[model samples]
Target: MYRERPAAVITGAVLWASEAGPDAPPTRVLPDGCLDLLWSSRAGLLVAGPDRRAHLSRSAAGERWRGVRLPPGVGPAVFGVPADELRDRRVPLDALWGRAAATLAERLGPSPTATALAAVAADRLAAGGGPDPLAVRVAALLAAGATITATAAEVGLGPRALHRRSQALFGYGPKTLARILRLRRALALAHGGVGLAEVAVRAGYADQAHLTRDVRDLAGVPPTVLLAR
Candidate 1:
């Protein structure tokens, strides 16, 4: 069983919980330009970093998990590290927060709730003075399908400067973020019953084949397989 809701204390953050069924298979978690603070019944507290490709997660049968999903650009402030440093990795919270993480884990106990995780993230984020406005703007522009040049101009940064900042903010350059967001858009459209050809065009792909290739590259599956799930 799984459920999620928007976190009341943090903008664009989600609080989620899940229990792995006895027969559950490894789950494929697609890249979504986010970071997560997670607590597991068996693993204690951990940080789930941004991903450039899909991540396959295996869990013990009946394990319970709770997490606070932080939107792009919001994690660095909360985690006190550049997003790139933790990309494609899941590390124990103690590695980053040391004794503090251990303290938080004790507070969470064995059956941590998503609400508790959200409160912790909110408190840390507030102390960090919040996410960078420029990084947030960059993610918005790219997700909205703006060209990289246009996004940089709107943000008043040069291309090189923008790329450098993006690496720290999003764990990748703007071009990669744009591609991931576009793939997400395409999936949304396809799931809504839109035809593949139209979904490709609407999502900025050149054609259905282009969309298929991008989906396979980033998600490790073709569009048809993803949609079936």
Candidate 2:
């Protein structure tokens, strides 16, 4: 079972929980330009970094998991590291926070709830003085289908400057984040029963083939397979 809700403690963050059944198959987690603070029944506290491609998550049977997913750019503030450093990796919390992570692990006990994870992230983010305003703007513009050049201009940064900042804030250049966000937008439209060709056009793709290639590139599956899930 899986469920998620908007995190009340942090804007644009999500609190989610899942329990794997004995028969559960490996889950494909698509790239969403976000980072997650996770507490696993089997693995304890862990940090799920941003991914450039899909992540195949194989859970132990009956394992329980809870996580607080931080928005892009917001993670670097809470985790106190550049997002690029942790891209495509899932590391133990102690790897980043050291002794502080140990203390937090003890506080979470054997089983942790999504609310607890969200609280910890919220506290740390507040202490770090919150996410960069420019990051927030860039993410918003990209997700809204703005071109990279336009997004950079909107944020008052040149192409090279924006690319450098995006690496630290989102673990990739603006173009990559833009592609990921576009895939998400396309998927949402497809799931809503929109036709594939229309989904491509509406989601800013050249056509259905363009949509398929982008989905396959980032999600490691064709759109049909994803929609079936």
Candidate 3:
């Protein structure tokens, strides 16, 4: 079974999952413009990089895993690496942090649980400094449906400056982040049983067709198919 919840000390969402039995691993993963730090019983510690499209993850049956999903503009600071380098990749934490990753893993001990993982993340963020204020503001404005130009102006940055910062922080520019966030909004509404047409309107899409196109582009599946999963 899979489960997710809002994290208290962490800046973004938390998710944990375990296989019910000897079943095949689930295959679909949609882009959410976020980076995930994952710990698995089999894989140990791995950092799942920001994805621009749906990805397929394979694991053994009955495997268990936990993750901290860091939001846009926050990961680069928390992970201590440029977002650009990690984009569209799943890398072992040891590769990036070397001994530090080993030390953190040692702190986690064997078969680390979600609470332990969160504690490690909290300690790192506390030491590394919190997220950049400008990046946070930019994320909020774009998520709230502001235009790219407007968000840049509000953040007191020019278009190129905003793009550069966004690339460093989000692994993509603001325009792509806006699209991903809108798809996320629509998916949330759909999960809450909202009709597709209303989801499109409320998510700021021009129409249902627009919503469908965006969903397919990002998720590699139609809204109905994606939601059904």
Candidate 4:
């Protein structure tokens, strides 16, 4: 499948993809309950909510999930991106759920995930309660860190432990997650018209050059290119 979102939250990524191929959008939502699971791949999706608290969820293939509640916030704004971006990226389902919950909360209030979250989190916990739980937990704790280890320790896990769990569940490690998070932050900053050098330092990169590389590595283009997109 290919993505074609025009915009995401200026603070986060809002990837776009098509509704075709082995990779397709998950048909989950509500009228009594407003929710949706948009899959970019088996590993990720854009979980959105109509109101209340928002959050993210993740599990293995065929793994069941329970929706989780988050602090009140807005779900990621995905107005415009492109279908092709979904081709190479596989974001963690947990992260997507979180973004969804947060987004919904911001738009609605502190109860967006009340029913849906209560339903799905148990399934997710039961399915993915292996050794990798630590990684998922750590990633969740990384709310505002620029570096990987800071976030890892905050979650009471060492870098190695975080890395191991990330590998098992996310197919990468804490380092990779942190890197992506930083770049996402940078993208958000750039979208807000922040200077590239400022985005770098605020996001924890040493300089604009480093930020450029990180942006290209994950976004397949430079910060300027993404900004244009």
TM-score, prediction 2:
0.99
How far residue 30's Cα lies from its native spot in candidate 2, in Å, is: 0.3
On a 0 to 100 scale, what is the lDDT of residue 16 in model 1? Answer: 92
Model 1 per-residue lDDT tens digits across residues 73-162: 899999999999989999999999999998888877778899999999999999988889998999999889999999999999999999
Which rank order by lDDT, best down to worst? 2, 1, 3, 4
**Model 3 segments beyond 4 Å from truth?**
none
lDDT score for candidate 3 against the true structure: 0.84
Each candidate structure's TM-score, on Cα atoms with residue i matched to residue i, is 0.98, 0.99, 0.95, 0.46
Model 2 lDDT per residue over 1-229, tens place: 8999999999999999999999999989999999999999999999999999999999999999999999988999999999999999999999999999999888888888999999999999999888899989999999999999899889999999999999999999999999999998998998899999999999999999999999999999899988898
lDDT of 3 by residue, 1-229 (tens): 7777777777665755555347665577777778878898888999888888889877787777888887777778778987878989999999988999998888788888666676777777778877878778988998898999999999899999999999888888999989988888899999999999999999999999999999999999899888877
Better of 1 and 2 by lDDT: 2
Give the clashing residue pairs of candidate 2, or none. none
- CA lDDT of each prediction against the hidden true structure: 0.93, 0.94, 0.84, 0.44
User: Which pairs of residues clash in candidate 1, taking residues 3 or more apart in a chain or in different chains?
Assistant: none
- Candidate 4 lDDT tens digits, 1-229: 2233322222212223333323333431111111233432332334444221112223334432223322111111121112122222334444545565455445533333223333333334344432233433554555366357676666676878866655543334556556655655777788888988888888888888998887666655677866774
